[model samples]
Target: MDVQGVRAAYRRYARHYDRYFGKVFHDGRKLAIEQMAILPGEHVLEVGVGTGLSLPEYPDGVRVTGIDLSPEMIQHAQTRVEDLELPDVTLLEMDASAMEFSDASFDHVVAMYVLSVAPEPERVIAEMRRVCKPGGRLYIVNHFRNANRIISSLERALAPLSQLLGFRPDFSLDEFVAHNDLDVLEAHPVNLFGYWTLLTAAREPTCRGGASPDLERSIRSH
Candidate 1:
């Protein structure tokens, strides 16, 4: 799906996202945050923060900037932030593939259920790495093409409907991690009988020395 397709599909789902997706995806979301072990006063960037279902769960002492491609979705997140009185939370409608933040702007970055719907997943992850400080954590929660052959085929069959579904059902985990060169520290299945995977990686300490930036090194041009 292209940018416009993603925006249009999400605009339609923005209004009811929480009602349909909030609770079911809670376990993975909760686990992602817990594993990050965020410290007070640290800055976190949450890409594709639809409806801000995870907003209230964050520590008030930390600062969180969440961005989404759909204005309608961000608007819901805005409302959620206000209603929940999320202290240092900010919501913006922006493309994940192309963000406006400066390099090394965040202490940690997370993309929950975001990669599948992103127009350019590579660019999005690059931006995430670019903005995250060296040695910071990266967390991703998403569903990938199932390992079982029958299920994998069924997932691939749904690829044509991605524009309407707002996310590709056949996204690959191994290829994505390898292509992005993420040094995944831990990866495990979570939520509803392991329908989704939670992955966490850490940037090497040498990144600040400009030894290896953005994990993929070559993606900085994006």
Candidate 2:
């Protein structure tokens, strides 16, 4: 989906998002935070913080900045933060591909179910890598193309209809991680019969596991 499309779709989804998507997406959100082992006072940035569903799960002392492109979605998140008395949480209406934050502004970054809907997933992730500190964590929880050929073929066929669907069905995990310069710690299935995957990585660390030096160089040069 394009930027405007994403905004419009999320605006429509804002009110009923938690009701429809909350439970299905809950386990991934919980797992991301728990795996983070985030300490008190750490600064965390969440891209596409729709309706602030994950706001309360964060540890009390940590500072959270949640950004969403849709003003309507961000508005709901703002309300959640306020009603919950989440003093350390801030919600902003901002573009993920071009965040206003300075370089290395956060200690950790998390984006749950965001990449598939982003108009430019590469740029959005590049921004995530830029804003997160070196050696800091980047947690991405989203659906990617599956290994099974039959399922993957279905996803590929569905890719062309992503705008209508509001999410791309054929995102590639290998291309996403390799080109982002991420030092992946681990990647595995999560949520609803393994429909989504959690990819935890370090921003711009030495190539580790699946990331090769040449791939890192290619992204760095761009």
Candidate 3:
């Protein structure tokens, strides 16, 4: 979809975005936030931070900068941030591909369910990596194509409609990470039986050392 199309769709859905998605994706959203585990004093950048659903879950004293493509969504997020009385929070309407930040600027980057809608997931991933500090982390929680044969068939059937609705049918988590040279620390199958992918990774510093032990074991087991 073009920029205008994306903007229009999101604008129309901005007010009801959270209510519609929060209910359908309630469990997945909660799971994603639990996995983030942000700590105080950390600098975090949240991409596609629609409505700031995860804002209240963030730890106090941590600096959060939220970026989104839709102005309407950002407006709603700002209001919610004010309602929570959160300090050190900044919201920017920007493209993920062209992030206006210096290299290694963030201690952590979280993009929950953001990639699937991006026109270029790889470009966004690279940008996310670029902004994250060498030893810092990138966390992603996204819904992907189901691995189960029966479920996969159902997803295939709905692919066309889903795409028009701003959802990519399926993206290979492993391939995307490896292609971008990202050091994936951990990946978990969360919600909907291997349909949702949760991942944590670091930049180049940890790449040579390899991913975390827990992550290795999980990947090996799966």
Poorest 10 consecutive residues by lDDT, candidate 3:
208-217
**Estimated TM-score per prediction?**
0.90, 0.89, 0.84
Cα RMSD to native, each candidate? 6.3, 5.3, 3.8
**Runs in model 3 lying further than 4 Å from the true structure:** 23-37, 192-194, 205-222
Most TM-score-accurate candidate = 1
| Model 2 per-residue lDDT tens digits across residues 114-202 | 99889988898889989998888889999877767899899999988888778999987767776665677766678987778787887
> Each model's C-alpha lDDT?
0.84, 0.85, 0.76
lDDT (Cα, 0-100) at 151 in candidate 1: 86
For candidate 1, report its TM-score.
Answer: 0.90
Clashes of 3: 0
Which sequence of candidate numbers ranks them by lDDT, best first? 2, 1, 3
For model 2, the superposed segments whose C-alpha errors exceed 4 Å read 205-222
Between prediction 1 and prediction 3, the one with superior lDDT is 1
In terms of lDDT, model 2 sits at 0.85
Name the best candidate (by lDDT): 2
Model 2: per-residue Cα lDDT at residue 89: 93
